[model samples]
Target: MVKSYHPETLEEALKILVETHCIPYAGGTDLMVRYRQGPGLVPNFDRPVMFIGHFPELTAISEKNGEFSIGACVPYRDIIRHPHTPEILRQACSLIGAPAIQNLGTMGGNICNASPAGDTLPPLSVLDATLTLRSVSGERKVSFLSFFTGPGKSILRDDELLTCIHFRLPHFTVEGYRKVGTRKANALSKIAFAGFMLKEKDMLSDVRIALGAVAPTIVRSRELENRLIGQPVAELAELMPDLLKSYGKLIQPITDQRSDANYRKTVSLRLIKNFVLKEES
Candidate 1:
C-alpha cells in the first residue's frame, strides 16, 4: 500500500524525506494530474507521498537587504497579489492557467515540475533567481540557471525540499514578458520570452534575455547580452538581424503537440526583436 505523510513542520518533513524517500507534494496540480491511472481515472500514489504545502516555514514571503525571498509554497495567486513581487514575475504568474489553478499552484511545484514551457521560468531566469534547498543534513543555494538539468528534471536531491526562491529586486528601466500560445488564456507556451533592460542615458547598460520552451531548459545567452550591453538603443535596429541569427542558432526547439519547431523559432525571434525595439516610458 502507498504510504502518505503530512508533516506540520519543515523539520518533520525533512526527516520523513530522508527516511521514507517520499515524493514531496505541494499544490498537487501537476502530481495528481500526471498520476491518474487506469480507465477508472483514479489518482495513483504508486510511491510514498508527503504533503508539505501547509508548512508555515514554506509559505512566508519576506524581504531582506535588497533581495526578496518567496517561500516555496506561496501560490501563484498570492504571488500575483504580493506588493513586492517583480512586475515580470507578476505578469508571468497572472498568465499561468486560470483562476482555480493559479490559486493552488505554487512556484516551487512549477520549478520542480521542470516543464520546458513553464511560464515562471523565463522571468525567474532573467531575474537571476536562486533557490534555497534544505535537507536533513543542511541547506544550500543554487542558481536557477543551474537548477534544471533537462525537461522534467532538476538537481533537487531526494532528501531536500526547496525552501525559497531568492532574487535581487529588479530595477530595470524597461522589462517585458511574452508567451506565444494557441490562445490568450489557459494555454501552454509554444515559446516564451522575458527581457530586462537598464538604460543609462541613451545606451543600454544591463540587458538580460531569457527564452523558454525553446530548449531542454530555459535558455539565457550571456554572450548575446554582452553584445547588447553598453550599445546605444538607437542602434538596435541595425544590430537586430545578427542578434536574431545568434538566437536562431542558440534555440533548439522540438516539434511538439502545441507547436512546430519552425513556428517556435520564427515567433521567438520576432518576440526578441520586438523586445529590443520597445522604448521605456
Candidate 2:
C-alpha cells in the first residue's frame, strides 16, 4: 500500500517532500489519468503521495512590483476569474477543459506536468514566467523556458516543491493565442501558438512568439524573434513567408495519435501568419 501525507502548510509540505521524497499531488488531474485502471475508480499508487493542493500558501494570487505572482496550487478557474490575471493567460486558462476540471486543475500542476501540448505553456512561455521551487534546504527560481527538458519532464528535483510562478507584466500592442485541437474544449492541442508584440510608431520593438505541441518542449527562438524586432509593421506581410519557412525548419513535429507532422506544421505557420496580420491591423 502507498503511504499518503497531507500537510496544511507549505513549510510542512517541504519537510515532507525532502524527508520522504514522495510524489507531490496537486489537482491530480493528469496523474490520476496516467494511473487509472478504469472508469469510476481511484488510481493505484506504487509510491507515497503528498497532497499539497489545498495549502493556503499555494493558493493565493497577488501582484507586486510590476510582477504577478500566482501560487502553485491556484486552480485554473481562479486564474481565469482573477482580476489581475494577464489576459493572455486568462484566455488560455478559459480554454483548458470543462468547468469542473478547470476548477480542480492548477497552473503549477500544469507546469510541473510539462506536457508539450499543455494549454497554458505557450502563454507562460511568451510571458517569460519563472517558477519558485522550495525544498527543506532553501528556495530557487527557475526560468520557465529552461524548466522543461522534454515531454513530461522537468529539472525539478524529487525533494523540491514548486511554490509559485511569476512574471513581469507585459505591454504589447496586440497579443494572441491559437490552439488547433479536435474540439473547442476538453481536447489536447495539436498545434498551439502564443504571440505578443510591442510596437513604436509602427516599428516592432519587442516581439515574442511561443509554439507548443510542436517539439520536445515549448519552442521559442530569440534568434528568429530578433529578425523581426525593429522592423516596420508594414513590411511584416512580405516577410511572413520567409519567417514561416524558417520556423518550419526549426519546429520538428512528429506524427502522433493527436495529429500528423504535416498538418501540425501547416497549421502552426498559418496561426503565426494570422497573428502577425492581426497585430498589423
Which residue pairs show collisions in model 2?
none
- For model 2 the local lDDT of residue 71 reads 95
lDDT of model number 2 = 0.89
Lowest-sum lDDT 10-residue window in model 1: 38-47
lDDT of 1 by residue, 1-281 (tens): 56889887899899989998889988999998899787766677878999898988789898777789999999999999989999899999998889999989999999999998999999999999999999989999999999999999999998899999999999989998987888878999999899999998999999999999999998899999999998998998899989889889989999989999999888888888988889995
Q: What would the TM-scores of all predictions be?
A: 0.97, 0.96
TM-score for model 2? 0.96
Question: Model 1 TM-score?
Answer: 0.97
| lDDT, candidate 1, at 223 | 96
> Could you list the CA RMSD of all candidates, in the order they appear?
1.3, 1.3
Task: Judging by lDDT against the true structure, name the best candidate.
Answer: 1
**Top of the candidates by TM-score:** 1
